[model samples]
Target: MSKLTFADMQNPLFLHPSDGSSSIQIEKLHGPEDYRSWRRQMEIILTSKRKLGFATATVTRSTEDATLGDQWDSCNNMVIAWIHTNLSPSIKKSVLFFTTAREVWKHLETRFALSNGSRKYKLNKDSYGLKQNSTSVYDYFPTLNVIWEEMDSMNMLPIITTVSDEVKRNLEEVEKRKGESKLFQFLNGLDEVYVPMRSQLLMMNLLPSVETASSVIQQEELQRQLLSNPRHDMEMSAMFSRGQTGGDRVVVCKECGGKVHLSDKCWYVVGFPNGHPNHGRILMKPGSMNQSWSIWNKNNPGNKPKPAGNVAGSASNAVVFSPQQLEQLMQLLPSLSKQPSKASKTDDKLDSHFSGMMSYHNALNNDLGWIIDSGASDHMTPHFQKLIMPTLVTNLTPNIKLPTGDTVAITHM
Candidate 1:
């Protein structure tokens, strides 16, 4: 026979007495939260190797036989090697003096056994408070599972014995109820967008397994995205409504000049100034018309017209201000060139400051109007349509002081 090498001796068939199929790999214990899992894995590995007794049994040095002592030493060394390899470097030094497997195991058990009242209370508190805020089902479920497993390991779940058929049936019923309760709790923690799906899940006679529910919810989420997208909806409508030789195209509206629909339903008919039946002419305010004339003069330097007073015109006719005529008109009104009153200047400053402050402070909703007041006895607004309870005060009301110490008349409240 060929001599057996060290590599051959290291094989599971030779080194371990059990069947060489099942193998255990202990994951590194990061913290107290991971202790229960690590202990369970360690137990499995030790049991498979037939060295579990080393974790609980004590050896008497004086009376122990040489062969038994050697076996105990080998088992202790193996356990130590396994722990050292798996431990995080930061915690490795703390257990260096542990001479036996039993000592190390007991130390770890005492350190993180979850028997302390305060620790148990905290665990319970955290498990109850846990919510799936902003986290996906895949990410959130694992966090809840970890807590549940830890609670189960601590014997937190209620237990019932199955000694008889009736007892077995009761136990099964209890377990099913507990499973359903957990499923509901998981669903409750999800975002409100999943309310419809959650309701459907609750209606089922038999609750689906957590894995099945997760997969179904994910698929439903994908379908919702596909259906909700405007681009996709447009594509589907185009595909279905298309004729063999391309269907009739959309007709542009003559009134509003929009492609959505016909001119009879045009918004411009109701809204635009010139679109109304009685409003045949385009209405232009005096201030806007003056500004337009100023812009026109600036663009065409040769046609520059000096500032002139108001010009009269028919509803349909335009007021033409020739350069020579405008210059002669400007010489007539010297009062128009006078500086604004002190009160008017102050009012303008206050208005700009108040508007800026309101814009800065009001960040929530832009639709709402800001009411700036200092010591006003009554509230007044220019927006007459926005009045909640309109009891028209007299048209000529006394002036009110603004927050900037400027006074402006309140025409209505």
Candidate 2:
């Protein structure tokens, strides 16, 4: 009770962080390069704890009483210790012996904080020079914002007391101009690939703020990430392009409303390229692709090529079944259905058997970039090597058979 001071009653150390040993939970300061960000964080923590006054030298020791003086000294030591805990090993050694919180803070400031002119010049230079070169928009946007924030801090508008409509309007105009400048800066620094995105943003009527523009660009980045994977996209395209390949994973295309390809490098949409059997012809269309072709065909019907008749000697003659032969085939179909096939029937038998089995052979056409296989197969792939990243299903259902005159079911689909 005797050692208790009036300072304890008015400005209590209980509200402050306990001591230097009490670690500041923040990104530890490295050096001058990290000083600005570190300082901003430190200020927030110190201010909340009411110990910032000690660092600033605004909270003074009482000369009138020894008890109050001791209280101030203890608080000052605590503040000084808190700062030290956040410093790098190299920086800690230099300020380790500083007697007061104010002295430590001033020494660090003098060592690290750049002069207004130099810092302002550097920040301005960074704002212009900063580009989303090789990095993602998620990573690059934040870094650009950091530079802009520092620049804004350096060139803050002056506070005015006399309020007027004209002043308010003029201030708003200044803000709009500043926003426009930031928007341009953000768009300009994007990689050349995003020219379409940048153009779209710029073409907006009211002109979006930097924050709005950044959000749009970030979404674009995510879409770009999705579109960049050629394997996934090409696989997706093949689902509809050549035929169905069995998989549960769904691929939906934004352009043509097709289920498989974002590589709307899609054979269905773009049609087959040169050398492909379906070249210069629309192979398949899922909605939009069909509509587009219909419009194109209607617009240029003369340019569309007519299908060519097969040359007589190229393959074989078309067989014409007599009424007697048709009756004989129908009688044989019933007897064929009961017998299990010992050997895997050829793929053409799939339709003949009326049993839905298909040959899961990888007749890979490199020109078409997809395996020509129907989805109604007992196995997804005939070759073991094609199962590059296979997931085994443990729990089993009774294997469904396509009534193939002969379909050999393998262990893995």
Candidate 3:
């Protein structure tokens, strides 16, 4: 039912007392805008009171509880006071709160009784009771109304005479099942359900089949092999060369006899010292250092031929760090433990480095905004991105050859 207006005095829920305190002082307030302002004022007052060492608590209402109304009865005065003081005088208003449910129920029952009987209650009856069916009076009412206007018709006699006891019982059962089934369907759709194993298997069988196909292909290219001819080991080379020209054999590298990059492979194995034992290749096989070097080159294509002139005079050879930069790098010292001995300093040197690193590190810990991630596999930071020409690495050891004496290590914070 729609809410009862104050004019509906019989509505117990909307009751206004006739005597003294029962009368509501409804100092009308504008809508939500004024309500919010009043609420804010109450908060400020409560906060101030709390500051003055007075205890205060805010009792809020759940939707259902508030609708029930009992809690608001005693607080009616406080609500009125709040509305009057906090809201614009033009908008503020007050109303009395009812305390009992009995009054509200009584008013509602009275209002219901006064409503037009024809509108509130629909009357119906069955005619032509042909089969003398037995059903509850409630069940007969709808059938009665369906044929009510036709009651005078001779053909109407058949319907009124005939409902079976079994039919009535069956209808009741069907109605009950319908209600239960609707509930089950609603709840089942909301959550997952376990299926019987056989049912699951049957569902799986009904699904469409999935098909996958695999293929293999082979091809040979021999242009490079045919082009390159050599003289150093003629006879043995002849046997090798003949196999390619006449035999079904397909060779990949005519220059170096390797499958991967021929030009690059030729340079390393023949030109660089590390290959064939005839040359002394000092750098370890391409790994982290080489990857970093390649990445740096890729990022800085313009850095080719020589270092930039602006950086030429600086300790371009030595690593650089500002005092603040040095302080920031110190935190990363803890993470160095993950590196192998070859990649990091000895325990004593690290301890010494920590001692120096921490002194500066601790002083700036609060203000410096730095983090030590010894656990990180590689060093990275926002510090590098911040500079006009950001020095990306700090506390770096330069020309510090590894035991192999070919590659160097640089540390950064």
* Highest-scoring model, TM-score: 2
- What is the C-alpha lDDT profile of model 1 across 314-382, one tens digit per residue? 222233456874765576345334534546765565454443232111112113343332222334556
Better of 2 and 3 by TM-score: 2
- CA lDDT, every model vs. true structure: 0.61, 0.71, 0.36
Model 1: lDDT of residue 16: 45
RMSD in angstroms between candidate 3 and the native structure over all alpha carbons: 32.8
The stretch of ten residues in a row with the least summed lDDT in candidate 3 is: 211-220
> TM-score for all predictions?
0.47, 0.54, 0.15
By lDDT, the best candidate is: 2
- Note the residue pairs that clash in candidate 2: 236-260, 236-261, 355-403
Error of 1 at 262 (Å): 40
lDDT string, candidate 3, 1-413, tens digits: 98656556432223233323322233233543233233334446533322111112133333677664553443333333433443344433222232232232233234332223332232211133311143332343334333332222212323335669987897677656544433232222221222232233235533221110000000001222344545546867667766655653544554444543444556444566444564654433334343544555465453332321222355443323566756745765655655565443555455444432311111112223532323324343434431223444665656443343355544333
Over 149-268, each residue of candidate 2 has an lDDT whose tens digit, in order, gives 878877888899997999999999999999999899989899998999899888888999999998998898888888886798777676665564355566677655665567556676
